[model samples]
Target: MRQLIIRAMATGTVATLALGACSSGSSDGSAKGRTPYIGVILPDTTSSARWETQDHPALEAAFKAKGVKYDIQNAQGDKAQFQAIADHMLKEGVNVLMIVDLDAASGIAVLTKAKQEGVATIDYDRLTLGGHADYYVSFDNVDVGELQGQGLVQCLQGQTKPIVAEVNGSPTDNNATLFAQGYDSVLGQLYNNGTFVKGPNQSTDNWDNATAGKNFTKMLAQTPNIGGVLVANDGMAQAVIAVLKQHHLNGKVPVTGQDATVPGLQSVLDGDQCMTVFKDSVKEAQAGADLAVNLAKGQTASAANAMVADTVTGKLVQSVELTPEAIVKSNVQDVIAAGAVTKAEVCTAQFAAACAANGIK
Candidate 1:
């Protein structure tokens, strides 16, 4: 069983502080002398634009502000490239290594190697099921799914026995399972009581948008009555919306999404998508940087006040879990106010009127 240990703390932002005097050893757990260095490995760019547009810059800013030596790289969805990047980082002698694993097997290999080398490791954004990471940093993902579920339920109000289809993220990603767990808790009751009909559900490979489009297309073909969709993120939501447009059901069938990207927010404003969950990547990145900095300095990561049980290992891992917010058409401006997206990005000429109507200047 998976467990979550939570304690009361501010969830908005994590402060980045400069490093103090270095410890004896290098950041890579090497002989005493070299400065501490941190390494980060991102999963892919094709899954979502946030990997490059949001998380990369936020993490760079946080690390640069603290004068921390770090190398950040993306695997571009290739397992070999992911392993190669880790090998390079380890060879370069980083004190702390962080990763958003593409898959558990590859992640486990890298984390195990990092541990064998005596370097500290962190699972960032996406937790590796059984990886030997010292800490984990991410938003409460189950809450994200619950928000998507509740948002879908609200959007589906007044529909008679609506059929809901799920276009989930990659099957290999642990976050996808947690997300399904969350939304299913709410939607399952409706399915059991006959309040809603469950439609075709499938997981896309590596959260590919094109695969999501194909999966959703097949679902629509089999069950033309799919009343709502629970898409994992904005990229997949866009694909699902495109298919809905072909059937002239874009705005008619509500869709739930996450990551509050510019296009996702626009879809919500345009009434094409019902709602999206906003997770401030800056906050998540800052928390990760704080943890990495502490680990590099051979000190305890104070931000890891929470605990998450690794189901594969049955071990409780220290974590820093943040909160996520649900964003609908009515409150799209909140994402802009939080600086996750700019008004100009979401309020283009096509959506200008919608933005104005929603109180966005």
Candidate 2:
């Protein structure tokens, strides 16, 4: 839930993205004439829509441009299925296997198997805790959480003894852990300083929005004075907003979310959501492609690999960590202008006036 990705997370540039369109796929599903194959395993269709909606398409374009054959599939949150998919890809003799683990345990197994088969593995988006991988590709996850926490602090400007409820992402997700580290640093300080009150702080299982909504509703009931909410991603934030509306406390409470989803942005436009974090998908996909493509070319490592410290392993895995952006009413136009979203998409009939009002055109 890192609030739909802090409602983010996409990364980007026209020239960087253009690399994906540089080469076309070969007829034999190989990279040029290398007989290269790349396999990507996404955690689940439910955890984040970006897996299918953004990463898949972007990776496909990247691999196509490199003339590489690839197999990408979703695990559907099942460990068995993830193993099965990995088995198949291994049998395909893939040169690189990238995965977004559902949990560290399962991810470790998959990574271990890939290593045994002599395939280069990538820890994409979510890190496989304590697992060995060729590289990791994701955004500055802790910073993503920090943005949410900072945004929530701003939202609590007028409130007194504001009860700040935290709806974090799945505990098993590495990105979630980093996000928690970020928000906790910010909000925890506030709670200690008597600036904000700590209310219900819970992590969702599998980043389930339904569970997040229910948990948030119960928190509201127990802490009738909840003033602001820090939801890890846009999906859970949307759920929380629904519950807020039912209690007639929607816009009154400043809700911070991550993942600049369509609804998250609209919520910001309507003032129901205080802010969202934006990570460009294209940029993240580009990073993963760079690693995967290089591996397929038999290159071991590159200087572009980012140095990221893995707290659990006491080692820094070669990573490609991008930055996150804070999305608010003041700067939302940046998202539209960056081609992350379109005027046609955001300027709906109800939002058209608001879009123009916000200089979105």
Error of 2 at 93 (Å): 1.8
lDDT of each: 0.87, 0.80
Model 2, 187-233: lDDT tens digits are 98989999888888999999998999999989989998888999999
Which model scores highest in lDDT? 1
Off by over 4 Å in 2: 1-34, 303-305
| Total backbone clashes of candidate 1, pairs 3 or more residues apart or in separate chains | 2
- In lDDT terms, how accurate is model 1? 0.87
Please tell me which predicted candidate would have the highest TM-score against the true structure: 1
Error of 1 at 144 (Å): 0.7
Worst 10 residues of 2 by lDDT: 2-11
Report the C-alpha lDDT of model 1 over 1-361, residue by residue, as the tens digit: 3246564354433433233454423354322335668999998888888888789999999898878789999999999999999999999999889999999999999999999998889999998988968888888888889999999999999999999999999999989988888898889999999999999999999999999999899999999989999999999999999999999999999999999889999999999999999999988998898778777876545553577878888787878888899999889988888777798888889999999999996
